[model samples]
Target: MTTHALVLKTFPAGSPRGSWPAEEFAARLREHGRGAEVVMDLVADSFLVVEAAPPPAPQDTSGHEASRLGAVA
Candidate 1:
């Protein structure tokens, strides 16, 4: 499974309804180029915005750097 982290939170305008519309919020994320999935955090009682998965870590294949640094591990 992939882990997603919170990126943004937008509270209801005017009257605080204590929650945001899930669909609208998700759509908003898409519109804003976030394009992530939405999850409701019961503990915080707020919409938890998160991407489907975390980005992949960068890879280094060149052994030159490791050799130069004398990294044995």
Candidate 2:
């Protein structure tokens, strides 16, 4: 299954001095009830603070169709 993520922010790879801004940002997001995580992106050569996107709501058209058909003529 293909997974999707919502990228909240991006940061460059940290320096040797241990300045990890992406992780800090992710931590702040988590504290606010967001399931955020920091992951390294080789293709982009940077760190990404991302959250898993919720699944799309199902398209339940049966109720709508029924209601439309029940209209008084």
Candidate 3:
């Protein structure tokens, strides 16, 4: 199955004071796995949810570099 990154944002329950970093949210998602869910406490009564997906592959910079080298050659 194709993996995708997801993010959810929610408001605080009854107070206005606190926030969660994206990294923190992502960590929770990783721990939970596919069906995991989390409610983040955002600034002044706000929250967020985060999901994880297979990390993207490294970019292929070698191809571009090779092309440039060929041109120089």
Model 2 accuracy (lDDT, Cα): 0.82
TM-score of each prediction = 0.43, 0.72, 0.36
lDDT of 2 at 3: 83
Candidate 2 on 1-73: residue-level lDDT in tens?
A: 8788998998877545768888888998889999999988998889999999987855656555333456332
Evaluated at residue 6, the lDDT of candidate 1 is: 59
lDDT score, candidate 1, position 20: 48
Looking at candidate 1, what is the lDDT of residue 15?
33
Candidate achieving the largest lDDT: 2
* Per-model lDDT: 0.61, 0.82, 0.53
Identify the superior model by lDDT, candidate 1 or candidate 2: 2
> What C-alpha RMSD separates each model from the true structure?
6.2, 4.6, 9.7
Model 3 error, position 11 (Å): 3.7
Off by over 4 Å in 3: 1-5, 15-34, 64-73
Local distance difference test, candidate 3:
0.53
Relative to the unseen true structure, what is the Cα RMSD of model 2? 4.6
